[model samples]
Structures are given as structure tokens and as C-alpha cells.
Target: GPQGPRHLRPLLDTVLDALHTGTHARGGPLPTGGPDTVTAAVHDAAGDLLPDRGDPDALRTLVHAFAAGAADPAHPLCAAHLHCPPLAVAAAADLAASALNPSLDSWDQAPAASALETLLTRTLARETGHTDGLVTTGGTEANQLALLLARETHGTVRLVHGANAHHSLPRAAWLLGLPDPVVVPAPAGTLDPVALDDALTRLPGPRGSVLVAATAGTTDTGLIDPLPDIAARCTAHGARLHIDAAYGGALLFSDHHRAKLTGLDAAHTITLDLHKLGWQPVPAGLLTVRDAHDLAALHHRTDYLNADDDTEAGLPDLLGRSLRTTRRPDVLKLAVTLKTLGRTGLGALVDQVCAHAREFADLVHDDPRFHLHDRPAISTVLFRPAHAPDPAVAAVRRHLLTTGRAVLGRARADGRLWLKATLLNPATRPDDLRALLTLVHRTHAEGPR
Candidate 1:
């Protein structure tokens, strides 16, 4: 066990060198020739799935193949999803987390990690005007937990959400065995407060029997709902509110953009994901509760992990913390990132990415070759090649993907398909934006290859 660190040092060098070699081989945002080709290459690199005796070079070989095949979000052209390029410092901390392999399920297994989690979650909860919170796998789990908590509070509460809400919300309702959700119209690409109020009034449920889920940022177009009005409607209707700020929650870090989340504090539970904008690795999500008492719904029991006797004996109860038993000390990387960057540094990155979106939107607006869907509400810009049929637009995105030219997302807004660019990489430059659009325009002009 003591030799673990020494053993890791040289292996890390090989991994880093392999990653660099793979990126060089890739020569673009992602590997060329699409899925089949990438799969074949990976299979070759992997050699045998399992061997009687392991190859010493397996780590370096696999890591190289992994990097080469990955759709690197750090690349300037890889502006597809809410996926973000993680901060270097955060990734470094993640390595240590993996090495120690602390399980948060028991205080004995992860004493310092447990304490760090408690301190971090509480501090982050206060940022959202909450009393306490839980660490989730991501927005999906957070949404599921929010629904779980709501259901526990009010027996079989109906889920009422906007059409703009993420698919996870309705799916979570289904998984929890709740009634089919009532979806209000998002005609303007956001939850229409009036429509939400109407739905709330018409729904046949007791005052506290409805849980209204609203989106702070819609996935397709990145449009934020009118949260203040939605919160007011929830208050008046006596319905509980859970705002999914997975995409826009990081705006809270920015003084300029934090005002956009004026009604965030009103939600009974709030889902905030950092992987999208916090420059952290995947699975960084939190669900904050306005009242710490709400977390009682998740209180769990087990003899080995968090025994009653152990809890009473001043050892912290860890079973009530999560839905999973063997979760990592994910808080470690987050804590490192927050401690290193603080609020202002992280906010500056947010501001820069938002600005990049605006600049890209401008490029699309000024070019007759493309049509800007709308000015970006956050850091997502939607634009389409001018007068291109929806099929052609879809074809253009696929062409770029297959050819490994660029990575861009597609969305349906205003009954038309538009190219979606979610600019989460703050390092992206204006020239890169122009090149991305040029790739789309050129592909559309040349037709699908």
C-alpha cells in the first residue's frame, strides 16, 4: 500500500505521454471516419479483452486509444453539448481521489472526504439560498432525487413541468412510479408562466400534491424560463418547486449573470450541475433543499455503513447522504477547483464563454450564409445555414462528424432545425468560431459526401 504512490508516478508519465500521442494522431476535435473506424482502432489497441497474464503496457495502450477516440471538448471546434473542458487542477485532484479510492458510504472508509463533503455541500447549499444538499451523479440523479423527496413529502404528488424541461424529469417521474406528468407549453422556448399557472389551476390535486419542475436552461436552445413568475405561480398554487439549473446554475458565480437566476432561491429543491460550466469532470451535480428537514426523506439505515450505535457514539451517519453506497469522494475535485479559482476566477470563465457565444451569434447574423436563431441567453448559440432544408442541416452536422471536421449540435427551434453551438470552452477564439461556421457552410454547399 505504501508503494502505491511510487508505482503511480511512472505510470502517470506513460499515460500523459500516450494522451499527447493520441491527440496528435487524432489531429482534430474527434477521430475521423466516425464510429466504425474508431471502434476498430480501439479494438486493435486493446488487443485482447482479458488475458491470463496482463500486459505491462496495457494502461498506456488503452489510454492512448481512449484519447484518440474521444470527442475532446477542450478542442476549440468541439462546441457540441453542455460538455465542458475540465480544469487541469480539477483533473489533477481527481487522480488523487482515484488513487485513495475513498468510499463516502462510511466515515471510517473516508473520514476526511466525508468531512470535506459535509463542509462543501453546506457551503454550496447556502449559495443557492438552501439549508442543505446532497451530491448526485449528475442532473438526472438530482432530478430523480428531487422527485423522490417530493413524493415522500406528499404521497404520490403529480409532476407538472414545462415542455422545455429536460427529458430526465419526465423519465424520473415514470421511474418513480408517479402519475404521468402534465407538460405545459413552452411556446417561446421557455416555460410560459401563464401556461404553467393555468396547468396548476386545472390539475386535479391537493394544494401540496403537485410538484412543479421548471428549467433554468432548456437543453435544445439554452433559453431560461421566467423563473420569478413561475415561482410566484407555485407559491400561489401551494405547489412545490424544483428548478433544474443544470445548465445555467453556474451563472450564480458571475455578478453580471447571477441576476438571471433571481427566483432560484424560491425552489423547494434546486438541481445544480457543475460539469457543464464549472470546468469539473463529469458527475458533478448537487440538489439543494431550502429546508434541511426535507433531506429526512433520504435517511437510510444499515448496520455496517451507518449504524445507529455508531451514529449515537458521535461517528457521522453516512448512509443518509446518497442513493448509492460506494460513491467516490467527488467533492475533492470540486473542493480543489473552488478553493483554487474562488468565485471571481470561475465567474470570469463564465463571462468569457458567454461572450464567445455572443461573438459567434454576431458572426452568424452578419453572414448571409447563415441565420441566427436568437441571441444566446447563456452560452449556447443556435444558427442554421440560410435557406437550407432541415434534412440538409441535419446532413451537414453528420457530414462534419463523419469527416471529423468539427463538432456542432443540432436543435429544433421555431419549427426549424438550427445548428447548436454550446460554447463551454472559454479558450475558444473568434477565428475558431469563424472556422466552425465555415465548415458548416462549406459542407452544406457541397452537399453530403
Candidate 2:
């Protein structure tokens, strides 16, 4: 009898090599000069060459290079839009979720994940004074689901949004197979209940079956629509009220901003993005409804999936309520983050970010070069060169990104291109923002010229 030959050499060598490799060095101020080369070097035989395929190490290196060149949201200087660098604890949770690979489609497959998701969704609904909801991939999906549910619940004829509502609202309407949404212009990114009444009044048919949407936080202007008045009108007109609080939902935890979302508790449905204001990892959005049965009309089941008998028995499944399949366990990240940072801490973080936004707005207002759109209600600061002509302002905005200067944003507002900044990081300070603004001005002044 012969013992099997030992083939442990490769494993041992790999472990030893990994140990010797050490860690990545702290590179000097990120090379704003860009990489020396953009193309992948395929000929290098440095490591992991697969005879039939390609060099694995080289492929990995090339991919890393590309990803590194992309925007690093976590960077101290990277503040562009709603996306922010996640907290370290949440990132760790995300890593754990990826490793566990929970699907949440069924209890048998993901019992803990399903339970946790249900609990988290319930908690969120309670926070908004709603009774039912589900986690979504982002604010867009949440808003879409809210509108879809509203359409089914009340048989609404028309969908309406304040002019300043996020683009996602109309996008949601189009996605739900509805006609172009009826948009009423807001005076200053804050929905006017009177304008909404007028829009409903002018509609071709009975406006009783309309869905009027009020934005809790308008993206560019960070303004909250008059939710109480809008709710009252929706009730009087027999219309359904939907609030898109994707950006301002975090303010629920803020004493000062809670009043802005005063009527949210009365809305038929509402959308919120934990990733935006919750400071949780991305893909943590939620849609809540006042009644659980409102979602029954959208209930669907396949023979291979849950049948009516199973659903009647209360078998746990999220597939029928969502548009996605084989979805990631986003709830784990959200729950873990929330558990680590209690509601109070989370609320404080949101308050800090909003305060910073106001501070930045004041700084911009004081500077003759920059202009403020309006006093920021949430964490967004939209501005452009004060008194600069439309073309010049547009050029400055375009140059900021093109020249590798501070990354700001541009939007067509009030018939002009307005450069905007959204404070995504709660840790960001006014001094850091001032530095970013300085970089933006320098680039705008010199780059395009």
C-alpha cells in the first residue's frame, strides 16, 4: 500500500507569498496628474498566467486601475451628489452580506435575512407612521413602487409632481406604463398647493382620481413642499397624496426638520432613501404605505414560486412586492448600520450634515463670485457664479469637471445652468467646503479660458 503523494507545496507557497507581500504604502497626495498609462498591459507575465485564458493578476491590476481612476466618493474631497462614502462599520456589514449571499426570496433560503428585512421595513414604516413597506435598491425604485401602489390602490387617472420633485418621480410614472406625468411648476423648488389645485382643476376628467406628489426635499434647491396643505387638498379632492422624501426622510430624526415633513404621516404612500440621509450604505431605500392591503392589487405569483395557498399561509417572500429577482440582501447593511449607530446618533449625523450645508451656503452667499439658490433646508447647496451670464456660467460648470478640479454639478434651473453641491458626508466641515469652492473658482476662472 502506498500513501497518496503530498501536493501541499502550492498552498503553502501561496500563504507564504501573501504573508510577505505586506500592505499598500500610503501614497502621497493622490496623483491628480492621472495615471501614466490608460491601457492594460497584457504581455506582462508578472503573475497568475492562465495558459488557455489570460493573466489573472494582470486582469485584476487593470480592473483596479480603472476603478481607482473613477470617482472615490469616500475621498475627503469627493462631494458631488447624493452618493456618499459609507461608514466603516456599514462597509464591514456589506462585506459580510456579500460573503453570506442571502437572497431573501423565501424563508427556507434566507430565514434570518427575511426576518431582518421584515423587521427593518416595519421599523421604517412605524417611523413614518405608516403600517407597511419594503426595502428597495434606491430612492428611484422606492418612489416607483410607491407610485405603482398608489395607481393600483385608488385607480388614479393622473400623476402629478411639483416642478422641483426629483426627476425620478416622472421617471417612475413612465416606468409604471402611465402617460407623461402632469407637472406643476413650483415657485422656488417648493411645491405650491394652489398650483396643484389649478393643475387638477384643468385636467380633462374628474380630478378626484389624481395622485398629487409633494417633495420633502427638492434635489437642487433642497426645499420642502407644503406637505400639510398638499395633504389637505388631496383629501378634499379625493386624490391620493404621495410624498417623495428620498432626500429629506433622514430629517425625520431631526427635531428642527421634522416639521418640514409634518404631513408625511398623512400621505397615502411615501418614499425614502436611507443611503441618502440615513448615512447607511447604498441600496437602502424604502417605500411605505398607509395600509398593507394597498399592495395586494400588485400581488402576483408564479406556479414555480408561491401560489395563493402559500401567500395565504403567511409564507415570507418579497418577490411579489419588488421588481427585482435574486436581489442582494441590502437590509443586512442597513440594519447593521442602524444597530451600530442608534437612531439618536444617526439623527445627530444628519443634523450635522444639514447644518454644514447651511454654513456652506452662507459662505457661498458672502463670496461675490458664488451665488446661493436658496437657504438650504436639507444638505444640498446649489449655486453658480453670481451675475455671470448664462453662457459663462455654463462654461465654468463644464470646465470644473473637465479640468479635474473639484467635482461640482450643473442643472438647468430658472432657464440657466446652476452649479450645485450636495453634502453627502456628515463628517465634512465648512473649511473643507471652502477649500473645494476655492478650487472650483480657480478652475472655472482659468481652465476654459
- Best candidate according to TM-score: 1
Off by over 4 Å in 1: none
**lDDT of model number 1:** 0.93
Global local distance difference test of model 2:
0.73
Candidate 1 per-residue lDDT, tens place, 318-358, comes to 88889899999999999999999999999999999999999
TM-score for candidate 2: 0.86
Give the TM-score comparing model 1 with the true structure, all chains together: 0.99
Total clashes in model 2, counting residue pairs 3 or more apart in sequence or in different chains: 0
For each candidate in the order shown, give its overall lDDT on alpha carbons. 0.93, 0.73
Residue by residue across 216-328, what tens digits does model 2's lDDT show? 88777677888889888887777878888888888888777777788899898889987877766777888998989887876667755566677689876566667766777
Error of 2 at 156 (Å): 5.2
What lDDT score goes with residue 273 in model 1? 94
